[model samples]
Target: MDDIGEYIAKESIRYAELIVSKLFSAADILETYPRRGTIVPQFMDESIRQLMVDNYRIVYQLAAGDKVNILTVHHGKRLISNTRHFKKKK
Candidate 1:
């Protein structure tokens, strides 16, 4: 949880200064619980949409060791395409 927070904090100041600061108060909360349920899932295995800051969608997956794998952060307008390969920068 600490690692996830740290990574997000460093990744974008906009996300940190504007979003996360007012949101996700502590990563420990996530650790204390098992798994939080999600909504708007088109498929059972592909992905799930979590509401945050009223507009953000946090796309994540759970691993074997209770690890929360954050895959992507996207806005409401452009829904995440249901695809396995997200294009990477060259």
Candidate 2:
């Protein structure tokens, strides 16, 4: 939005709010269906899955005791493999 200039600052804020609201709604679904999300194509790990919300990918890991840890929320246009959140530990 910064690059898009201040003309649409209000629009940007609204979009952000909408995205966040949808994220929470998706999380609520995970409470009952943890495996609802598909395995992340970047890793193919069953424990790590992702949900798509608008233009973002909601990456998450199924933790112990039925808890879902949100790993990241990244733009769909970018490459996620390079992100530290999914990097291989050295």
Candidate 3:
């Protein structure tokens, strides 16, 4: 995530900041908009869904009691199979 910020900062500092803000905003939206993302069938987990933010994909899951668990934020071009092993950092 820090790498993504650095890459975008090279283009424009404001744009980079905005991108990070949008990422957080997307997460907030998920709290109230859980079904906004579509199911990712490759994982065969219906709870897993992805929300798009520009060229990125904010992958998350719906846990028990409707809690939102953000799994990862990845580039849209990457294959879901490659990210299937991701475990959220503590």
- lDDT tens readout by residue for model 2, 1-90: 232223334568676666777777887889889999999887887888998877767788888888888887666687776467665444
Overall lDDT per candidate, in order of appearance: 0.51, 0.75, 0.80
Scanning candidate 3 in windows of ten residues, the lowest lDDT window is 81-90
The candidate that achieves the highest lDDT relative to the unseen native structure: 3
Which residue runs of candidate 2 sit more than 4 Å off their true CA positions? 1-10, 82-84, 87-90
| TM-score for each candidate, following the candidate numbering | 0.53, 0.74, 0.81
Off by over 4 Å in 3: 82-90
Model 2 score (lDDT): 0.75
Model 1, runs deviating above 4 Å:
1-16, 22-29, 37-40, 46-51, 85-90
Clashing pairs in 3: none
Task: Give the per-residue lDDT digits (tens) of candidate 3, residues 1-90.
Answer: 677788999999998899888988988998777888988766656778888899988888887777888887878898876453443333
Model 1 pairs whose backbones collide: none
- For model 3, state the Cα shift of residue 14 in Å: 1.5
Give the per-residue lDDT of model 1 (tens digit) for 2-89.
4434566788756656565434642234455425536435545533424444455555555457765555655546666767733221
As for model 1, its CA RMSD to the true structure in angstroms is 7.5
